[model samples]
Target: MSKQYRILGVIISLAIGLAILPIKLTSEDLHSGNLFLAARTIRYTFTAGILAFLLHLYLNRTIFAARWIMVEYILRIIVIALIICLTSIVVDAIFNKFVKESSFTIAKEDLNWYLVILRCLLVSTVQFFVVFYLQLVEESQRRRLEIEKLNRSQLEANLSNLKEQMNPHFLFNTLNTLSAITNDVKVKDYVSEIANVYRYMLIHNKLNLVLLESELSFINSYLYIIKTRFGNSLNINIRIDESILPTKIPPLSLQLLLENAIKHNVASLDSPLAIDVYNDSENIIVSNSLLPKKTNYHSTGVGLNNLLNRYQLLFKQDIIIEQNTAVFSVKLPIIKS
Candidate 1:
């Protein structure tokens, strides 16, 4: 509803309540001779109009909370009654010159102005609560929308990070294999391994997950390139069960772990490195013996961090990492398609 219409509605409701107050207050039937009744009605109309405008300000603008509803209602009742009674007495005194005033007073009989004030209080309290409830509902909906927006932004950031990591990893390994092939005479086998590895990485790197068998075959082709380059030094053992070959796993996940192993560990013909790949109870396991490479440059630790971030983005679960005196292992959960 428009603001103007809502303001008009409040005015109409107050006018009706003020109009009815006089008839309800009179002990006898409402009649023309009852000057007091008419005067009281005019006084109430002025008081209620002022109170309604003040209430609109309080309900919409005030930051204070009503901790004690009963106390608030009682105070409002007292204030409205005092304002109306004072206005009525002044209006009666002013009308003495223009018209005759009623002399039949109710000093002998007892009256309770508190009851009428309480009735007005109940109506005002109900209006306040309705407005408060609607505002709370609007705030709740706004917060929910904000949370969804944050989640979408986080997912986009993770996807971009994962995309960026795959390219450099493939480039460095391919170039290294090419450099090794320059000195050796195994051109045909080296070229074949490079072709197979590049073809698979290009096709699957952008995807979130691929079948366990497909990822394994890609990892095997990658290991082939690494092994051909390192020749007699890189030892890889696969212990996968054929039963879960169709399950889904993150694309190029195994290749990343294998790269980390080769980058950080020592591997030569004299002390050949051992790397193991297997699956156990819905997880892919990659473990390698610790033999730090003295000649390699220090890494900035982006590979493992990238893997952790991607796993959290896709699964909302932590990948298990365990390291001890002789071995370091990582366990990745398999997500079934």
Candidate 2:
């Protein structure tokens, strides 16, 4: 605990002690008169306040670790009541032994144990609520911090993905392809498709989720660029249900998967790279044949990892990956808008 909170506790204890002084003085008779009564009231108030403060401190730590709310609260209340009862008995005994004609003696046969227990129970109940409210405030603050941290991390990831997409290598490769295509008509079309791909990236990269139809349309433009570069060596098949078109997904998810397939696998006239995109009942499935290249592709695994993080942050869902000697596949959960 900070010095500030400790000071607050002291102030609160003193305030509570002052508040109960009148009740204690009025309820008991002091043979020595008002001075003795006042002294006893001060002692009683101080004891109660200290007990309450100590109970709060102990519970502040224990309550967070406790499971089963009802059981924990019941146990805490019983413990608090017992502590208060024992402390009151001790205080009363001290006063009876030293103070002349102190009426608040627990040793007396007429001393009402029922009222003592009732008072202890009432105080414990109030203490329990105070601790409960503090716990709620602590929990709310913790949640707010977690949300802020998550948002910061998510923004960084989005920026990294955008940088990856706009890298000079990708732009250079597309320009290189355009330069080699001698036909003016086809060159114009390819340039248009490349523009569309980058335009989509610029527009939707910052968003958490985009409509499935919009993503599909973006992927078509992305594929057009890829197909222009690879020609007959690459083949992509897409089969999606129109009903799921209105669903939402992380932008560029399909494009990332497709890029991963192309980057890591062999694509040629002899051995064409085959990729399939379709919708299962609950997921959008992306599967490609596992044809490894002789020269291993340098990959940092950032794209798929970023996609995983985005999926978890957005929907609390995991993208399923299935792989074997012949095929590699991923199942992205279709989140409803």
Candidate 3:
């Protein structure tokens, strides 16, 4: 109902309670102290107070969970207003209809809704501040956690970039120096290939994602070095469609996978390691034969973790890794051009 009408009803009830109620109840009724009247007053007061308390708890628990505090606060006010207004109406109706005295006539003042609304606003304001303060504290704590996380991520990204720069550039410069000193064509070409691999890394390491074709070119240079190192013991195959070459992935992803496979597995002439690279409709698959070395190779999970972090940061996507008795494989998601 409209506020004015609600106020009008309260004014009419106020006229009855103030003017008529005194005329209805004389000094004799007041001195007698009727047990029924006292019981009802206690019942209604306790019930209303308890209901408001419960409502406050309910609203605090459920409403404060929302992201926007103002929205929740407004919602609480609306809800509280409706509940209190409706409850006052119900209680007043019950009291007037059910509770009767033989001394007074049928009609008498029941309740003053204006007073109820005032009390509701007062209680609502108190609870709002309490809940709002708690909400503020909670939000402050959440923001602090987020800031801490962001700072940690920034530090890690800086560290990763540092690693990218120092490792690659050092190798690149070292290889260039070796190339200058080399006399033989085979040694010079090998050094050049290694330089090429490091150069590719230095150039693309800053990028969030690289086109598949560019990554594959880097992989080609990287594979040459691996092949030169391992010879016939490593059989690495690539069979990716040209259509998906335009798709994108985090830089160093394939290289990391290849290095992970080579690092963790036993590559020997007696037991050659077979690594395969191909693409399905959704993902690029990297698979290698499982041949664990007896030697304790420290598995820090740096390479795969780096790839996972890069992909998640760039695209909010996860790379799939699977292994069994025979083959260990990873599926890198393809981000379309």
Candidate 4:
């Protein structure tokens, strides 16, 4: 049986044993401090054991079936009481065995089987209350855990949705810039690169992983769009090890880092923001010079928080961020799917 089954058995057993203790103590010979009191108690406890076993069997069947009919409850209590009375009689028989040799004769009469049955019923009712109370507590705990698990799942779903929204928003911004640069035929090849980035994002946005080469190519297309918008004001560079090109990364991760770089820092002709993408050891590092754009609206930190939460769900690691007056950088671990 499972640990839960064992624990439940132990709980029921302890409760029944305690319930029967007072009855055994009040028995005629028990209060007289007879030498065989311990033996009698043990013998009588067998009946309580049988009753407890029956209770477990009945409850195991009824509880999880979502069936709590009044008749079933009444029957279970009756069965439990019968077992207790049977065990009490057995203990009395044993006690009489030792007492037979002595001259102690209290009341010699036929066993009051009806009264014994009534006593069993009363004790069973008490045991039922205790067991029912414990079951309620256990059910409450299970419901609490279920609610917590549901909340966790909902949070993850919400984060995934926000990440999905970000992809299109980023694409719309980039596509708008590409549309404005139609007259510049000299950057046609670069325009194709930007188109390829949108193509990949459109195709693979729902995917969990993409090859590093594919993702980097997408990043280049994305950078092309950013460059078109800022012109000479923004400078971006990439230096990746060819060996790691086949590695897998979460989709649109690099885009979020780039967005953060642009959103927070100034990019202009006077102090052009240079964003770098490269590999150092096992980390994919995106570093940019800290030059805040002299604009009234800076940025809310939600984008990065969403990205960090997304990474945590997928990779179980935080997206490392470092910033100073002159520089700001983020390190994302390259992982294989």
**Tens digit per residue, CA lDDT, model 1, 1-337:** 2365456546664665564443444444344356656655554554554454445435464443568766655565455445545554465446554555344332222135565455455445544444455556666876677566545644554575556555756775776778666865577566666767776766686677789899888888788788878988988899999988988877778888998998899899998989999989868899998998777588876667667766776676678899998999999987665
Q: Model 2 TM-score?
A: 0.61
The lDDT for every candidate, in the order shown, is 0.66, 0.76, 0.70, 0.70
TM-score of each: 0.49, 0.61, 0.57, 0.51
Tens-digit lDDT track of model 3 for 1-337: 2344334433433332333122335665565467644544333343344444446555666545457978877777767756755775676566567667533322244345565566555545544454455556666876687566545654565577676565665767788889889899989988887777777766776666789999999899889888998999999999999999988887778988998899899999999999999999989999999998889668988667767766765676899999999999999988885
- The TM-score measured for candidate 4 stands at 0.51
**1-337 per-residue lDDT for model 4 (tens digits):** 2367546755666556655554334455554576445453455444565465546455744543336566667877887787777767766676676667432332333256666676578767766765676667776887687566545644564566556555666766676687677767746666576667767866776676788888888887888788878999888889999988998887777887898888888788988989999998778999999887667985777767766766665677788999888889988887865
Worst 10 residues of 4 by lDDT: 101-110
Deviation from native of the Cα of residue 159 in model 4, angstroms: 10
The lDDT, on a scale of 0 to 1, for candidate 3 is 0.70
Q: Give the top-scoring candidate (TM-score).
A: 2
Instruction: Compare the candidates by lDDT and give the number of the best one.
Output: 2
Model 2 stretches astray by more than 4 angstroms: 1-135, 161-183, 296-298
